[model samples]
Target: MAKLDLKTADVPKTREDARPPDGSAPIPIHSRARFSGWFGYVVLVLFAIISLGPIWIAVKTALSDSGTLFTSASSLLPQHPTLFNFERVIGLVNPADPRLQQTSFGKVDFYLALKNSVAFTLLAVVPQIAFSAMAAYAFARLRFYGRRVIFFLFLAATMIPSVVLFIPNFILIKDLGWLNTYQGMAAPYALMTPFAVFFLRQMFLSTPRELEESALIDGACYFTIFFRIVLPVHRSALATLSMLAAMNAWNDFFWPFLVGRDRSVQVMAVAINSFRAQQAGGTPDWSGLMACTVLGIIPVAVLLIFFGRKVVESLQYTGFR
Candidate 1:
């Protein structure tokens, strides 16, 4: 063997020795990392602006006077930035005021519509979530004959266009004499949706079976295990599903419009549309319209804001993962 020089065999190279032959200083690792971080933040900021632009415009329009909107259509900030539109939309404005007469103000039973929306959302979401969770548990945990086949069939229902089912559902609701009623409004959505079952089943499937086995050893029944063990452990999943179902129920228009058009049961969405249609001057009440839009959006926005992290965590740990 050749004589080995141990003195400098594995000595680390100096910065200068590691430099390229062109004599340019190599970029520091920290500098590159910082640049990448900044680039990512810039991209996120740009996307945020793009996503929020229309919402901001709607807010701006909602706050502006109707005439000012026409006069300064390009303005980013609302002219005079008044709450008159919001007050008018929410029925806080005096009905006899000259200002109220000029626009579609105080003509809408917005509070009633808001109440109906809340009621419909509750009716739709509570039963749907409860039934869907039970179905998901059965699909995920119970081993019965044809379970897989039934689940696959449920999955198949998702592929069917929702519009294709509407006529049949409408007929069913009408035949049940549920027209213009909260029950009719909720009929299509009050029970388990295929998607809800599928979503909860995935989470249930991912849950460790050891807990259930332990519960079984302690003489716990299926319902006991499901309610005490599984449901308690998946609170985040349940909350996420509830928020999604609530948002969907809150925003639903077409079904409610078709089956619940009476003023007593009109939802916020249909009410907003009717408000727009009832304007006197043949001109759209852009300010009132946008104000109604914002009001209708507020509850959903608040739900997302408060429970948004739970939603993300549920998706990350269960379905998406």
Candidate 2:
């Protein structure tokens, strides 16, 4: 006799008991996921607005007419926008006229200060990059006496406040007859930046040892390996360092003011202060001042915008590896 089919008997029947009485549709997982994504985007948009609102306001104010800006209330958008303020403050309005201070446009002296800043940056950054890279290479690759001690000394320099060194630096510059000269303003502080050495040393240390070892086997010198191999691989670090150096040089006011008394040697930041004092007889031209500030910041902003990704990526890579 054939055995009874027990598996078919155990199967549940699709009768009244198996069915839900309400007959309501179940919620879709995709719909819930879509709602979460939209919520995340909304939060991001709000954060972006919060972060960018102030910068937008400043730009709007800078673009607005000076008369309207002073008389009118604060606004996200200017009622009557104009480029005259920027033109005036950036020296596009009046190319000549030494005594003719352009309240709407910036002074020619401002441009001169910009030139001085560029010169100082170039003079300082080249040597600083070279020396720092060399020091970092030696620290990372070479086996030398007192290496740890020397590196520690360099690291210790970071703890010392820059203000404490100002007086001594002034005395040295005075003795060298470099006061009021570009050398006095840029040189003393340029090479002594321990941060550069430290940063570059870390980058060098993070490089694969086998690459350098291979280069050595191929009869390449340390400098050859560094210049030919390491530098190319770490272009991001170089870009970041260059941008930092340039920004520091351009924005340096206190040291330049102390060392460079001569109007000819004054940098843009120093010149802007002098302009404010001279222009504001009783009331400061907030519009013009803001305009100049905006102009002065453009180069740095542009640099960062273009190279910021590289800077961030390099830092992240250095940190991780």
Candidate 3:
């Protein structure tokens, strides 16, 4: 019943014929898409530059020589790039040098601060991760009375500004005689934070129930299931949480400044402040300061660089719900 349109089938459509029947110019969709893609790339590059500029400046300053820094401060690259600044920060600089004696590098005690920072981070991160994971499991898998109400209350606690809690928390810590102690510095953060709890809870909720059920059938306790089944399945998520917690603990300034002012317990952040103060009424050891900052950043930077993919993969599966 069909008549074959052989002539039309053989003929190629011209650009004009490719236009819609109404006969306005066809949209240059491919060109528009290309333009949009280029625009997005430009925006991303711009944001990257903005985000990384300061860090680049810090590195540049750190690499610069102290004597030549003022002369070449405006230059992008260090005029005389040297490791002397780094050596100075680490206290390997020759003390016999007159220039070294004039500065406050002796008072900075960077190694002590570094040790304290590592200690504080460990004390905060280990207990926090352990407690947060257990609490998340309870919220996600176990049934108990007032669970919803208690969980909501925990969520509500996140809405409360941290600054508002500082006074009460400070008074409590002071009353407990935790000032200038590593324990005092770590105590506030050692328990579960709402964000960590909420993060792990979402992950736990997403895990397949079948494995947990099977484990229970084998006469496994909740602890066994959590330790043997759940934790191994979500190791990436736990690593992500640890990295985040480490960064937070390392960079914290105000609280550590309040509670851990003594040199023995001072962290890297407070050490920077003390370094600046020791150089007061004089030209700051700009190179040394920047070097110290770079050293402080290296550990976390190395962690992120190595475990960055795990962090991204874990975050990819995280649901807003």
Candidate 4:
């Protein structure tokens, strides 16, 4: 035993004192991280400019007076913006030339075409989504004879190009006497999109089966589980499917053009093509064409803006995740 020296003895301090003064906190110095952050922002800005620059030019072109459009000094900022082009494009102008075709613009039925496109989209999209959803649910959850084989067949069918079926589809429509009608335009295109079913089926399958099992234990039928649980949980998938279906139906040109022999049933794409052809009689009205193109893009833009996130999330949930 050592003798106690009480007056000059050292004592152990608390554990807090064991830590360094600047303990795990790191101080960010002026370095590569800051530079990288600034660089990333700059790159983003440049990318945005590159992406949207043409769209801005289109807007400027659409707003400029039709006469001044061909002039060289039409900068990104229009020297003079006028609604005349929009008016002419929308058929608000009544031309004094009767011998010329009666058009909303000087030569195009832009409004009618837009209307037809909207109608076709509306008529086709709802049934497509509903039918696809039901089919997907059955394939995903229901155990039936030949279920796997049938699904395999559907998957195989998706590999076949729509263009290959065009002739037979056309003949069927013609036989049904649905030529140049809205029903004919929408019907053949709307039924049982294999890709849509496949997409939704994957989503439905990814959902935990425990929920469906619980529902079944409670005496809830398959339809009840689908409607109450599956649909609600997979709303994102539905939105994505609906948006894609609508886009396909709306932008469809070749099929509609071939089937819609009459002007009354012609979609916007066909109408736009017809407008381009008619306007280019001797000289192309690039301004009017640009205006029509802008108008045509608006609906799709709106749909994307509203439903794009859902579509992306749904796609992720369905497969990518």
Sorted by lDDT (best first), the order is 3, 1, 4, 2
TM-score for all predictions?
0.83, 0.76, 0.83, 0.79
Off by over 4 Å in 4: 1-43, 72-74, 95-105, 304-308, 311-321
Candidate 4: 10-residue stretch with minimal lDDT: 1-10
lDDT of 1 by residue, 1-321 (tens): 111222232322355554668989853434444455556667779999999999999989998987787777998999988998889777787778699766544367779999999999999999999999999999999999999999999999988887789899999999999999999999778888887898899989998899899989999999999899888898878887887777678778888999999899999989888888886577777888898888877875786698777665654433210
Compared with the true structure, model 4 gives a TM-score of 0.79
Q: List the residue pairs that clash in candidate 4.
A: 91-104
Where does model 3 exceed 4 Å of error?
1-40, 102-106, 312-321
Give the CA lDDT, 0 to 100, for residue 30 in model 3.
48
lDDT of 4 at 132: 87
Candidate 3 at 67: error in angstroms? 1.8
What Cα-based lDDT does every candidate model obtain?
0.82, 0.73, 0.83, 0.76
Candidate closer to the true structure by lDDT (higher is better), 1 or 3: 3
Q: What is the lDDT of residue 8 in candidate 4?
A: 21
Clashing pairs in 2: 88-105, 88-106, 89-105, 89-106
Better of 2 and 4 by TM-score: 4
lDDT of 2: 0.73
**TM-score (C-alpha) between model 1 and the true structure:** 0.83
What RMSD does model 1 have?
A: 8.8
Residues 186-214 of candidate 4: C-alpha lDDT, one tens digit per residue: 98757777878988898899888898899
